[model samples]
Target: MQSIRSLAARRLRSSPSSCFTATPASALGPGSARFPMAIFAAQLRGIKASSKLQQESTADTIEYSKLSDEDLNEGLQRETSESGARKPFNVEYLRESMARRPHRATYDFLSPGHSHLLNIALWDALPLEARAGNIPDSPQSSASEETSISQFFMPSASAPANNSDHELPSGHHLVYFPLQRPISLLEPDGTDPAQSPGVPFVRRMWAGGALDFRRPQNMQLNGARAVCVERLDTPNMVMRGGWGREKIFVDVVRRYGANVADLDPSPSMTAPEKLLALENKVWDDADFEERRTLVFMRAKDDVPEEDAAEAAKKPKAEERIIKSPREPEYSFSFTPTPTLLFQFSALSYNAHAIHLDLNYCRNVEGHRDLLVHGPLTLVLMLSAIRSRNTNSQVSPGRFIRMFEYRNIAPLYANEELRVCVRRNVQGRAGDERSVSEPSARWDVWVENNRGGICARGTAVTHV
Candidate 1:
């Protein structure tokens, strides 16, 4: 099989050089030629992120007085209900099932075996610091001796940062998390670990890292100049042993790409406002909290065909079209013609089947079609808005809060789509210039090739 390194090099060679030609390291990052690469290099220099999962779980249960009664009740009730209704997520059962499943992790453009071979090698090379960033419940390294932390960088997949003597093909940058010490698969609530056991095919490869998006875009976005937009569709073979409670599987494919950020292209954004904007963009590009939370949103059941058809045909008024946002607005569009579907079985690590596999979706999960990954959607929005900036003055540390998003519609394959980002009028109310302006939230709308909106949402950025 052709190696991942060869594949990546081949891809770089095959694509037009003028658009995404590799730049010298000095020209990357924010202030220097090395700005773009440097940004990722900094990420590789892992920051001290608080690792409390940030999602609801038994771990979040604090002693009385601090958390509200409502918050406490929600957690307690949810736990009790889950423990009673379903068996806790079966990592073992999933592993065995995955062994029988067809899909495997894939790097874009590589032949299947070559992609797997290349990714597996990188999985072996992943740095411990990068691995530590993904441990749920704040697991510490054995070297730390206590609840400790270390710094590592999350490398950019765009450029071969490790353009070392040895390289993986497919050019997909990947990170793997191997436990410094064995963590029991047992849930803290005390469930039977033996109930539906499966094999331990990939207990060590739990991790997250950015894929070097290799595409370009030149368009007007939110009154700003646009940079290259990435295209990561057909998340077919990628796999992850999901960490924490929902230790199933995940398919992190991004088909729609983002536009890069430039200096206040939007004449409306002032100098200070633009800099302030960097704070949240950087932080979010760094954090993965919301994605972690949604791991718990799996409501699989067999909705009767009548119900499914009825829901699809429900007489809902057409999504009202709007001219502009009451605040900072963002919009993005993409083609999904080379239609793709990513399948992540319960076995391929910790991901659930909700992400891929149309049959499981139809028969087991009971949906109209396969559901699109939420993280993929969020990444698309961020990439879209980020592409619009020229200054690229982002600082992950300055982030403040999450805006909001209402999943306006469900996205499916085979149709071209557009994603839009815009500011929130309510957030800005009187606080227009407050780095905390109404611009924090992005009103996101996903449109199909035929110009129909499938989903809409709002996202808040702190930077």
Candidate 2:
């Protein structure tokens, strides 16, 4: 099979007009007369170049050159439908694709190393007071000993063979990342395209998510293997700002449980049958469940020259700001640095350019700087709740049972942001809280330095 580089080269040689023209020597300045022709000859002499080289070089080339004709047509149909044209949107196709579930389950080991590294990264990002009781006192202790994660690494007899001593933390499950796509398969924005609603709706953002620790004790750090079964709900169309601007919201549900192989052994089953059985068992015996809402919208090209100048004149941080109305009973402020963002990205195996690439964030996403990851904010909220519980004598043994959160706005790196939590009454009248069960509800949010809430959530805890 011919590589894309060879195919591009062959096409360029066959169609010189599509690439470039050999400039006359008289058109060039002194000492650079033969530069263009020489480079052109070099490219023709089997010097490999990317298929996108010519397209990227030309100003008028279509931005969606990577997409197939069918994909382009589908996107065009959606655009026309949004514009009140007779062509209807491809609702059937969207429903079929988005609602499909994975055929096989993905597995990951509950490695202590993953937990330890995440703990270290979170410790560095936390304020001094938040890290006060969490870390050990001895300066001479090992790096692992300085964080609470060290306790999980200790040996436990009851732990699954080769697993850690303690159960995984509330939000530490983020570290057990999903399957990653190879660079060749990733979108231009450095995101996995498997779940994307194809073509023009390529740009994706983590809009919000929820976590339910139904049986948290089942997931431990003992190096035992666990399985995750994922399925996507039907996509919902949302109108944003004006009439022709549409966004697609996709809800991804993942259930984590012990690997079925370890629990049951059926040698007579075929591979596909075994996988189906495993997925069914996981759904029934899941230790915890996570649902992430991702929003996909059309990609924005660079602003035109005339508008670019005007946009440059305005301050990057001069957008609308909405402050939180509820005062916090506990708050911790810390600025996320580039290193912290990079570390978190690595821990989560998230290659989204918004978190790791500053240029992509500014030039493509129109952000002031690198954006803080949605999952990172969730982790911070969990950390804040854990810290509050650790310091309070009333609920020392309380654990987070359920958490629901939404991302309201973007939070930039190197900006001071505060994680705030306010305690609320346990439950409604005649509910579980009205009984002897000691529980609490907390309103948790993260606000920027200007006191604008960027992310907010609610957490329910039980003793």
Candidate 3:
């Protein structure tokens, strides 16, 4: 058999530059320029190469490093064909599953108590100095205010029954738990398998999501009724690594609107008609539109044993750490305790084993400890943005209009997590006027203790 290096050299000598061109450091932007070419190739194809490959191939020692993108994909396709052509899930079943949708709109009352509990949980998780501006004086004077507390938390005044004075803070809607399915309906990982592709593609991760706040004032925390209309888009499958490492991406779209009976007050409306009208109204006049992208992969056992062992042997500090490109205008560090994770899981009604059961995390998921909820990181990023705005020169009246984020890696409990926010400067270097205009666009990220950016996002604000 030909040695990997020799084969690589032969390919390099025969292949034209057009077949494989090295991406320039400038093209990759700032911090990403430090990554190896092999890593870049992996990222370009959305393939997360095993840590063993990453560790073994240093800047000076990469095997088959000059393989063209086409060559790599061809090899993957060849391997897939050789693996017996059996699919994990039936395509017909998947199509049937995608065709199904909830017939009625689900409703949840905007409870101040739920938001208050989340506020307290987050406050307790932050350091004393980090909590400086988030103190609540009254129900309406808490974090969601433009001036007083952090804009991420609901005011204490809103916590009382029948209080509809305060608006629900951005990202606080996560606490208004979703309707739960029967215990027997949950997947082995403790996730609701309602919209899942099927078995074997069981392990789920929140890959990324986007939130659009159209009318923030309409989503009040006044114990008023609210409706959420959810629908699942068609799923797309991608070959992340190889046959066994395949991943399915599912997009969930949720629209939130106030459940006011005045929309259609005809007493003659039937039950189904009322529900249909409510859903239509929610979709047409949604106060908040959210898109959540979830990626599902095979269970840990399905991964090659060699790869799993190599991952287990790797030190946490040595794991791939992607640094932030810009310095943060505001940064806050907080260590997530087991109790904090439990509280957040309870609040979100997420029973995922990776966030709760240590044995499952270590033995099954191959994680060192319980993982932090992905949505929790999103909340932290939003909070950091609000906190930075409170202390910075940005206008207090401005609110987050659009926010989008991607989760790159897992964050574990008992580890220090830092939320960083920086003002986004647009336009060319000579254009000071554009760069200095209140920085309506912002860059936000969450960093682990090792300086690895586990999650990164962008936020657009409007006055």
Candidate 4:
């Protein structure tokens, strides 16, 4: 049996959500499918040792050395009120509160359309424009045991090669993740009272968040020799409540970019010409036309139901069916299942009822099936690009400096999801000689079975 601490670490490595472990799938009981009895055992025997390891790895003593005494006092004053009784929110204090080992996440983007039937199946899985009507009639729409993914579980050491030739897509880092202290550390009355103070009636939850994409990441280059730092500024906290429930809203800002291998580092700059190239990649002519068509269709959809019916009864304008773009430079499709959701939830220590409770999702949340984790889709997108970048011509040491994304819509279980990325047009002025210092950008998006873009964003890379 794996030690509890090791198992927790393994689970954390696989999913960035929270630190919760699941019993082997075989151990799942029909009645206890949603709530396994094994998790009720409160004592995690090896957690103490693991806590020590975390402390040793994440202590901020060295970082503290870089701060001046005056600045240090300011941070302290900001963290504690005048008498040091009430805890004032401090940026440095918050960063120190959430500390853990550098995160690593790995994913295997199972290929689509490998088998003959699978191709037809994948075609049918796409949204209308993407499928291009190639789906054979009566082709199997159901998933089979053979089609299930075999490598959903990723270990820490399996972290995708940061030095790969292909630049990973924006928003890929969510595949692996971050932390809060152990339960014992969070409750002063428990183990080490001196380490943490207890706060009765305090509740915390992951409110939603957003990412701002400043530039693309060069997957072709590696960042092993580069120094990367993520700065988390203090969050603006707001309080709101109604219907006997109160919530705290936290708005945080995080900035991350790469620098040279020097002891003192600054933002690694990208060449202006490379930036121009990335900024220039636009949709092909056909794609632009297709988008206009889709936009028109969408506009008609917004008409009131009564108006739509009347419009349908009247003479319609000539419909222009614009041909959509075919295969992109990088594409991968996968079916997310209940098991995948459960594993992800367990790995992230998420107990949100809507994710696992069918009744809640259907009755309370009004979702058709268990909802797919939104972050999971972004991870799949980035993973596909990373997989492609491994074979790309770009050099190593190009790391993803920033990625920004938002959920345009919700995704459900057992849906065939597609991730696609195409390099923006090359710079007109720069020759192929600038390949080594290439600054590339990609138009990245995730499409549904109906070929509708559910989420769209860009990935920029610099060397």
Candidate 5:
């Protein structure tokens, strides 16, 4: 096999170069003079030999040191050798599982509810005083320690007394739930244990998403049930740098209400009676729920465009740089570290490689460094907006109704970032609040140290 160095040299030599012709001896100055035909031919032959030797010396080849394609993917390289190559993504397989089974999670009031957990999440997320501009750090009390509190009071590991449930704030549900199973994400088909040939090991990233809160979620301090219904929509292709960025969206509807059975554990209750109790609903109903779209992004080889017209539509990220706004009503800056990334991942039970595996990030996804979580940026932006309400209250008669965000560029760890939010002034007709415009809209974005916007979006709130 031709070594990489040799290949590079050959490629260079093959490239177009300046016109070259030996200068005539007559053009030479001083003692230089033309040679006889026979002598010139002999000299030309000798010169050609010398040139060949020099080329060989300059083109010295070195063996490729890094793992070969086969070595890096030894077992997987030949898995589908006889079957040719399989597709990198199985869209049909994912589509077939469109109707996902519902899942339920129950949380106790004192289980360091979303509020405390989110504050704990900030411990690693907040920037240092040296960089974050005196932004107060979260309480030193660790989430793990808070979680252990319930265990300590439990009479035994098997059974424990129930505590009153607390209400979770908007967007807080994202922090409380356990991480989704990573199986279908990596192996959608799961027909084989090992990946097939030509099937790239794609890394999943948290692209920004939208959340719609229907009503306030009050935790059943006495133990309420959260019924979560999820559906995996058909994946769409998002154009990235010469690649087809697959956007996989999962729609989740979480309904938090009373657990009728737990509300009254009557042993003598009949099946019909229990069913009736479960059917009974009041303020706590599915009407007051939240719908969330969790988007996962993966890169695939760019599909060839049909023609120039189609190709012209795909513009690079640089083309849209001017669209990001600069000035904002409020801005909160902070620097994120790898420690925060690790801690946030642990808190959210997220094991995405781009956030944790530097090798996978560089070798597979082609990132310069570990990526900061997109959800973390969104959380920080929301937190910054919430901080403006000095009352330290969440529901102030006005609440954010809908929020949509997207990741513009990847923000690496330890980078300084500023989260900015501006109230939309487009529809404002007067200084005084009016019923005609009961809701307000705001734009939110995160900018890197270089003032490049890494993420941007808009939010709608009903005052």
Candidate 6:
């Protein structure tokens, strides 16, 4: 095995044609160098470079730190007044502004702290380009319309990004897969197969670092920001992150009901001198970390010590451990179906292809099969509650909080994963004016046939 020093020297000594010196990121235009693809790439490389490989390649970057939710809120309080609405969502702008700082992986000292600031920058910049192309052949078409991106992603050509869209390396990829066939997911219900939702838009880069946002609004929004950064790349690798989920959830609820938006609008201001006030409210809010105890299924050989410890520690979950005589919360455990995964990806407007394309997920995100977003568990629970309780409804507006959910295991395809909730009656019981009182504070958890919890939590009800 070669040492990192030797590897660096070998790569550096290689033909100039083989190795190129990267620019100081600052050299690029505002839009040229956006987002921390470089840092993420660094993380991936650092992980692969390790010997044992016990830790995750990417997740190691978040400390989530010990910051109380209120403390986290305080970090966002308007540091000063008149923080004008000057280019708030441009990834490039955010990058350029942030470049001046030191960089760090975990939040600790952050060698410098500009990584996530530009996270949502591109979402605001990716507008649907008209491109002034030749009129379409179809009679239904007008002068010019958006370029439809069904399954292709054209890489950008901006000043050469670090993570160039090149062919997969020898061992990095499991196999080359064609973008054909639907990825495996739950089977659709013939009875109520509503339109599978989501903007399967690909955020491809152009030759000169340009991108076309010709996708639909719901397909994309001001809340998105992406960058194929080179300055942050290692030798022959790349990394990138999307900024639509948070925006999508917020946008969807606002579309359905603005009242719901008020619950927790992270970055917004009012007409009154409440701009700072509004920011402070979020900055000073509590629950810096919203901890939810979840249950997930694991193979008999795969049950984790963390899960075991939690189970043993709170064996019966008596009234002593935030106890409640909440009904023995039990919910449906549908077998994994293709229809479910597709519906979820659509609802999320994510197009990395990992979620739908099991092959892509295994190839890029480097997961065992398809990985489920922790939030999806919450979604399934919400869906079940809606189906079981005839009158209970989900109101996004005035809906105030979620601290955080730590996923302890993966819910593989085809496996039956349960979602259960047994809430504490005296907790923050919701809807002071609801109809039924079947224990608003319910204890919830989902387990597999092996008796392993797949997802679990306590949720309030709005009758």
- Candidate 5 segments whose C-alpha is farther than 4 A from its true place: 1-94, 99-110, 123-167, 180-202, 217-225, 234-323, 390-398, 425-437
Task: For residues 200-233, write the lDDT of model 6, one tens digit per residue.
Answer: 2111111001111111111111112211111221
Model 4 Cα lDDT, one tens digit per residue, 1-463:
4443365446544432222322111211223211111111111111222345434534534575456545655665555442133233333442333221121111122111111222232232333233312221223334443432322222122224442322333443332222234664433211211111112113222222333332334211233222122211111222233211223332222222322222221212122222212212210000000000000011222335765576567532112212226557877677877877776565444445556778767764446777666656655544444443442444221333223344455566777767887776433213232345555555667776666666655454443
Q: Please provide, for model 5 over 28-143, each residue's C-alpha lDDT reduced to its tens digit, 9 standing for 90 to 100.
A: 12122111112222222223324554345234311211335344334334432321233344332232222211122222222333444455557444432112111112223454
Q: Model 2, which residues run further than 4 Å from truth?
A: 1-92, 101-104, 127-165, 235-244, 259-270, 302-318, 390-398, 428-436
Total backbone clashes of candidate 4, pairs 3 or more residues apart or in separate chains: 26
User: Who is ahead in TM-score, 2 or 3?
Assistant: 2
Q: Report the backbone clash tally of model 1.
A: 93
The superposed Cα distance between candidate 1 and the true structure at residue 296, in angstroms, equals 6.2
TM-scores for every candidate against the unseen true structure = 0.33, 0.70, 0.69, 0.38, 0.54, 0.31
- Give the alpha carbon lDDT tens digit for every residue of 21-84 in model 3: 1211112112221113233234333667566643443332232234444554454454434443
Q: Note the Cα lDDT for every prediction shown.
A: 0.30, 0.61, 0.61, 0.36, 0.44, 0.28
Give me the runs in candidate 3 sitting further than 4 Å from their true place.
1-96, 127-165, 235-239, 262-270, 303-318, 390-398, 426-439
Ranking by lDDT: 3, 2, 5, 4, 1, 6
Against the correct fold, how does model 6 do in TM-score?
A: 0.31
lDDT of 4: 0.36
lDDT of 2 by residue, 36-137 (tens): 222222232224334454334333223444444466557656654554442334444454433332322456777556766676787667764444133212
Q: Pick by TM-score: which candidate is best?
A: 2
Ranking by TM-score: 2, 3, 5, 4, 1, 6
- Model 5 TM-score (2 dp): 0.54
